[model samples]
Target: MKSYIAAAIQMTSVPDLQKNLVQAEELIELAKGRGAELVCLPENFAFMGEEKDKIAQAEVIAQSSEKFLKTMAQRFQVTILGGGFPVPVSTGKFYNTALLIDPSGQALARYEKVHLFDVNLPDGNTYRESSTVMAGNRIPPVAPTKELGNLGLSVCYDVRFPELYRHLSQMGADVLFVPAAFTAYTGKDHWQVLIQARAIENTCYVIAPAQTGNHYGMRHTHGHATIVDPWGTILADAGDKPGVAIAEINPIRLEQVRRQMPSLQHRVF
Candidate 1:
């Protein structure tokens, strides 16, 4: 278990859930062919549609008999990180959440979006996530294989908060996964920089899978699925293209960087 290969699948999802699942299956097969042990899909990989009504309609929760997740993981024989989906909430609302499926098709962990994206940028694109989606409370990390160790799980907007990464790292995570459907305005300006900063500061590898291109309605995503090293180096990046990127994680690099900086130990604030 020296190192493992991973891939991030970018998609231009639409209103049709079945069609999107088919596309995702094709991408999973592609990733398997390319020797990816773990593959991550972009946020809303299942169904991106007209508006809140569309997402709310497609909400699914911890149901055990989900064919899309269970069958896909078994078919690929690899860890499938299904990026955020619309989940039915208690108050008849929905929550954007990520689900992790193991090779055997069993769900390992599920993490809901903590920090919903509610912003009115200068581009006149106002997003009110709270209107439809419910906020999550706990920070969940997945313990995959003994060789791979613990992985911090986060959704799109969760990337902006450094405290989240810090919490994950403190909880013994060696890698962090952030699946996003970021807008073009923010992705172009801040996506890479923010991800790298988090990785460098935490001394952990950051694997981000993103949605690229326009969806069914007017929603557009900035697609650049990237993997960054602990030293803040951009190991792999896909620029506005739907494809996969791979990187070999070196544990020695993390140890070396941590030894050099020791920033994690220098917290006086």
Candidate 2:
């Protein structure tokens, strides 16, 4: 096993793709300066203007958006989770997509958001993300590396579903990611607890980068980009700002936690 540093970047992305990308690049460099080997960005880190804008900005795989991320990863010599972007699935529909790029700039894996947000919030704000974004086919999630341990891929809404995390763990995931853009209404109450629960039950490291502050004047995201260890202890947390939280992931600690609990092996269902 190996030990390495990880970082999660919180952002309050606006309507501009270029500006968002610039912010992400600067943040990635900053994380690298802090000796981070793996970096994750928040959901919708590229554009968050409107539904029409999201549709228009959607890119196909291997296109400009992915190219930019690969270039950045190679330049910084660090593995990067490209966060969530809208990828075209059809003429008017897109998939909420996440991709990981290695230090060599090769795309390692991609995870489209499986669970879509379609609910009415307590603040009278209603969203039907399924209206524009199509549901992913729900494939087995995969991330991380030989040295970093297995990483399970997830998006914002997927956090509410424990079975998905369990399935990923059964698929050999030792670490989990919940790159998100959770609404302020729900995040203030449910975010941290859900993320830590996933870590505790799976006995896996959980990295969750998030959107923060206000966007488009109509939406505000709760920003507490955090990293939790297998023992359900928070390793790092970024407050309500656009920044990176850095922490060292100790493999020894992860192993010890799993070894002591052994609950995963005791599952009957």
Tens digits of per-residue lDDT for model 1, 1-269: 24787888888787777787888888888878988888888888887775565544654423321567778789878888888888777786677778888889887888888899899978778888888788988776755566555777999898899999999999877889989999988898999999999999999989999888988546778999999989999998978977777777777877788899899899998
TM-score, predicted candidate 2 vs. hidden true structure = 0.97
Kindly report which residue pairs in candidate 2 clash with one another. Answer: none
- Those runs of model 2 whose alpha carbons end farther than 4 Å from true positions after fitting are 60-62
Error of 1 at 116 (Å): 0.6
Q: Scored by Cα lDDT, where does model 1 land? A: 0.81
Query: What local lDDT does model 1 show for residue 128?
Result: 86
How far is 247's C-alpha from truth in model 2 (Å)? 0.9
Residue 262 miss distance in model 1 (angstroms): 2.0
Best by TM-score: 2
Each candidate structure's TM-score, on Cα atoms with residue i matched to residue i, is 0.93, 0.97
